[model samples]
Target: MISHCVFIRFRPEISRARRDALFAEIDALRHTLIGIVAVYTGVNVSPEIGMDKGFAEGFIVDFDNAGSRDAYLMDPGHQKTGARLVAAAVGGGNGILVYDLDTGHCLVRQAR
Candidate 1:
């Protein structure tokens, strides 16, 4: 599995409603796309304070493989949403962070 992690620091001017709308748009992609294992989005709810810095909101998209993940990245619908996210981000683009990892066996439950 491929984990696509995206963290966002939205500008203060961006309303919660707008944020929710954006998240909803992303969630809707599963209906049109393939190989999306899962999608999760929410605000930071960590016990440790200040650890999140300014990135209060984020989303995770689990893909079946790199091919599916790449296809999603090149899709026009995703590009549109990405543009909106970048615009609403604190520093336009600097406020967003992305990381993709190949979970491989790490995601498996080993018998201890």
Candidate 2:
């Protein structure tokens, strides 16, 4: 299993409505892509100090395997979406942080 995590710090000028719309667009990809187990998106709401840096929004994409995650990364739909995300971010591509975790175990717990 693979967990694709992304943190985004959008430009200060971007309105809340626009940010919500972008998240909606990202959520829509679950239907178009293959091997996507789940999609989660939201804005950071933590009150803790200095934890988030400048990233205000984030998303997690669960995939069945590394191949599936890699395919999603190369898909044209993802490319388009990513381009839009980068355009709205603070420093173009530099404003986003991405991490992929290889879950050695199944993402879901098995029944006893």
Candidate 3:
């Protein structure tokens, strides 16, 4: 599985409703796209100060594999959604960060 994480710094002028709508559009992709296992959206909730570095909201998409992820990237609907996100963000492209992790390396160990 591939975990696609995107951190976003929304512009102050962007309304909460817009943010919600954007995330909604993102989540809606799962229905039309193939190989999307799950989609999770959230705001930074950690108590540690400054840890998020002003990136308060974001979403994670779990894809069955890298191919699925790449396909989504090229999807026209996603391109439009990404353009909307970039426009609403603080510094256009700079306001977003994307990271992908392979689940194969993730090891879960039970407590001793």
Candidate 4:
């Protein structure tokens, strides 16, 4: 299994309604795309001050494997959705951070 995580710092001009609508579109992709195990989206709610670093929203996408994750990256629907996200993000693409983890067994040592 693979977990794809994305965090976003949205531009100040983007409204809450717009953000919700964008997430809705992303959530809809789960049904249309193959190999997607699940999709989770939410706002940051940490009580610790200065931890979020302005990244107010995020999402997690679970895929069956690396191939599935690769396919999702190439999907047209994802491309469109990603474009919208980039546009609304602060400093364009700089405002988004993505991390992917392979949850399956590993033989190699984990990177530092």
Cα error of candidate 3 at position 90, Å: 0.6
Worst 10 residues of 1 by lDDT: 101-110
Candidate 2 yields a Cα-based lDDT of 0.89
Q: Write the per-residue lDDT of candidate 4 for residues 20-112, one digit (tens) a residue.
A: 988898899999988999999999989987798998898999999999999999999999999999999999899999999898865678799
TM-score of each: 0.93, 0.87, 0.95, 0.90
Least accurate 10 contiguous residues by lDDT in model 2? 101-110
- List runs of model 2 lying over 4 Å from the truth: 105-112
C-alpha displacement of 12 in model 2, angstroms? 1.0
Tens-place lDDT digits, model 2, residues 1-112: 8999999999999888988888788788889888899988998889986699988798999999999899999988889889989999999989999989888664777899
Residue 36 local lDDT, model 3: 99
Backbone clashes under 3 angstroms, per model: 0, 0, 0, 0
Top-scoring candidate (TM-score): 3
lDDT leaderboard ranking = 3, 1, 4, 2
RMSD of each: 1.9, 3.4, 1.1, 3.9
Clashing pairs in 4: none
Model 4 regions more than 4 Å off? 105-112
How do the residues 66-111 of candidate 3 rate in per-residue lDDT, one tens digit apiece? Answer: 9999999999988999999999999999999999999967897989
CA shift at 84, candidate 4, in angstroms? 0.5
lDDT of each: 0.94, 0.89, 0.96, 0.92
